[model samples]
Target: MRIIGIDPGTGILGFGVIDAKQGGYRLVTAGVIKTPAHTPLDERLAEIFDGLTEIIAETKPEVMSIEKLFFARNVTTAISVAHARGVAMLTGHKAGLVISEYTPLQIKQTLTGYGKADKKQIQEMVRLNLGLSQVPKPDDCADALAAAITHAATTRLGVV
Candidate 1:
């Protein structure tokens, strides 16, 4: 199965694609869609939508595994993230992909055997799990790949 994992944000939406098989997982591609810092929110969202839509088309992923929006201390940031998240889901749905949502805790636990694992720990696991020589660059990109890895593990174990 081909899976596209998304880490949504208005300014920097990260995306990773992986081919998951019974044998193992293979990284297809991973990167981020970055809008300028001062860009208007609506324009940034459009950029995200366009970029993700193109990615889905190019990669042709069968499923989408995305991190669910969560924020305890920053309502302002959370609201913008919510918009990005919504756009991501809509793109997946329109593309006819099987959409899956996973909490950050679930992703971290699936990758590192600890729900509260630090970003570095999870990124290291992502590299090890996929047999990469180095961790994926940019924290957002690694987080997106982690989401994909979590989905692969979950499905392989019959949990998804």
Candidate 2:
């Protein structure tokens, strides 16, 4: 199964594609969709939607795993991210892909066996899980990959 994971943000949305094969995972691509800070919020959202649509077309993923929104502070930032995330989800839905969302805690726990694992731990595990030489650059990209890995693990266990 080809899965695309998304760590959505207004300024920088991260995405990763992985193929689950023979009970293992292989990285296909990982990157960020960055919008200029000075750009208008509406335009940034449009950019996110368009970019995600293109990615869906290119990757041809069977499903998408996305990070669920959670914020204790910064309501403004959270709202913006939620908008971007909506666009990402919409793109996936339009492409006829099954979408699943996981909390950051769930992703961490699934990848490292600890819900409160640090960023370094998550990155290292993502790298190790995919057999990559080094962690994927830009922390958000690694997080997206983690989301994908979490879905793969959970689905395999019949939890999702």
Candidate 3:
């Protein structure tokens, strides 16, 4: 199965594509969609929507795994991220991909065997599991990959 994972943000949306088959993973692509800080909020959102649509078209993933929005200390930032996430979900829906959401703890547990694992640990495990030379950069991108890996394992275990 092909999965596209997303870490949604207005300024930078991270994404990773992974293929899971025969109990292993094949990394397809991973990167971030960055919007200029000076751009207007509406324009940034439009950019995000267009970028996500392009990604969905290019990857044609069977499933989309996205990080669930948790309450954040900064309400403004949280709301902006939430809006970006909504666009992401809509993009996946329009692309005919089943979408799944995972909490950060769940992603950590699936990737590093501990829900409290640190970011470095999760990144290391993700790299090892995917047989990649190095961890994907920009932390958020790695987090997105972790979300995808979590879904892959959950499906393998028949959990969701």
Clashing pairs in 3: none
**lDDT at 1, model 3:** 97
Q: Residues 15-71, candidate 2, lDDT per residue (tens digit)?
A: 999999876999999999999998999899899989988988998999999999999
Tens digits of per-residue lDDT for model 3 on 1-160? 9999999899999999999998699899999999999899889999989998998899889999999988758999999999999999998998999999999888888887788999999999989989999999999899888889999999999999
Choose 2 or 3, whichever is better by TM-score. Answer: 2
Candidate with best lDDT: 2
Provide the overall lDDT of each model, using Cα atoms, as 2-decimal numbers: 0.93, 0.94, 0.92
Tell me the spans in candidate 2 whose CA falls farther than 4 Å from its real position. none
* Higher-lDDT candidate of 1 and 3: 1
The TM-score that candidate 3 achieves is 0.97
lDDT of 2 at 134: 93
| lDDT at residue 30 of model 3 (Cα atoms) | 92
lDDT of 3: 0.92
Model 2, residue 71: displacement in angstroms? 0.7
